[model samples]
Target: MSEKQETPEQRRERLRQEEGRGNPAGDMNDAANRASNGSLVDLTGSLGWKGTGILALFMVLAFIIYAVFFR
Candidate 1:
């Protein structure tokens, strides 16, 4: 039985072909050209008016506490 081992160049070409087949048109690179694949932080959809008001109140309270105690 005769078995042929792949050369380094042949192996590299094979891997390159596999990568091309895995992601045609090199679109995967384009798609991954970002820090993350998800959207930025946006609470507008999840936070209702009441939630927004509460968040604002918390911020004001935090600022007041920091100023009154730290100053």
Candidate 2:
């Protein structure tokens, strides 16, 4: 009898398949839903609105500053 252990790739593939069968990107989906990936890094749903608002505010503030000081 020959002994052949499962390769790392095989194990990973099996685990991935099981993951798909069970939850289909469950952890990633959960992390995204929970806003766990951070706003600066991913900004997916975590910082979208806030980031946009901040950017708009900064732009308006910069324009006002430039109009007052530079122009």
Candidate 3:
């Protein structure tokens, strides 16, 4: 009797099944849950509008200086 060979799709399915058996929760956890309790901090609130504005102004000034003088 001749043995049946698996197709590419069948081989891929087998590999997926084996991976699922090895790590059942592999898909459950991801980069979205890297932060504990799913709480991504609000930098805007912590930094405040004034602080953020100052930072933005400084960044703009630096960019302008770089473009004007360096380039």
Candidate 4:
């Protein structure tokens, strides 16, 4: 008996069609959630006490410099 075999592209298309039957939006959301598992800004890790202090110090110093020089 002569049977026709699916080509690689046809197999791939069939698999893709099968995958499309699932929740694509849910899959995308799952991927996004995995990608952003933690905080977006990460202030706790990237800007700890020292970084916060430095930022506060810069703001205060800038205000003082502007008041003394320009105001």
Candidate 5:
């Protein structure tokens, strides 16, 4: 039987090396740049009109159904 042996420091070093090679910070920076450059649209203001209309429609329909069936 062969046993794999790895010390805690060796495991930590391996993880650190892997993370450095993966360059997650660079990916985050790219994402931030894209977001700041308007590649992503700001939806908070538009949602007030569209989402509110949909929600109000849903509430009206729910009230109509409840009145017809439950009361």
Candidate 6:
């Protein structure tokens, strides 16, 4: 018998497979939750369209300031 160490990605995939076996819709919800709450710019949770619009406005203002003042 041989043993192999499972990487984090492999572990997640295995767990997802196990989770899917029980409830199909649950797997989709789990994926949506993870995607919404993941570390890189969570868009769906607290950062709704209003926050996104504000952020975009700030970005555009910064760009205008940079072009007018710095360059």
Top lDDT model: 6
Of the candidates numbered 3 and 5, which has the greater lDDT value?
5
Residue clash pairs of candidate 5: none
What is candidate 1's lDDT per residue for 1-71, written digit by digit as tens?
11258754456556666777877768466446423554222242246567768888998999999999999
Instruction: Show model 4 residue runs off by greater than 4 Å.
Output: 1-45
| Candidate 1: C-alpha lDDT | 0.62
In candidate 4, clashing pairs total: 0
In terms of lDDT, the poorest run of 10 residues in model 3 is 36-45
For residues 1-56, what per-residue lDDT tens digits would candidate 3 score against the true structure?
12258654456557656776767687346323644554222344356578778878
How much lDDT does each candidate structure score?
0.62, 0.63, 0.61, 0.66, 0.64, 0.70
Runs in model 2 lying further than 4 Å from the true structure = 1-47
Rank by lDDT (best first): 6, 4, 5, 2, 1, 3
Model 6 whole-model lDDT (C-alpha atoms): 0.70
**Using Cα atoms with residue i matched to residue i, what is each candidate's TM-score against the true structure?**
0.42, 0.35, 0.40, 0.38, 0.35, 0.41
What is candidate 5's lDDT per residue for 1-71, written digit by digit as tens?
12248654456556655776789887577667868785312332345567757867988999999999998
Specify the poorest-scoring 10-residue window by lDDT in model 1: 37-46
lDDT of 6 by residue, 1-71 (tens): 11258754456557668879899898788778877776434442256668878888998999999999998
Better of 1 and 2 by lDDT: 2
RMSD of 3: 16.4
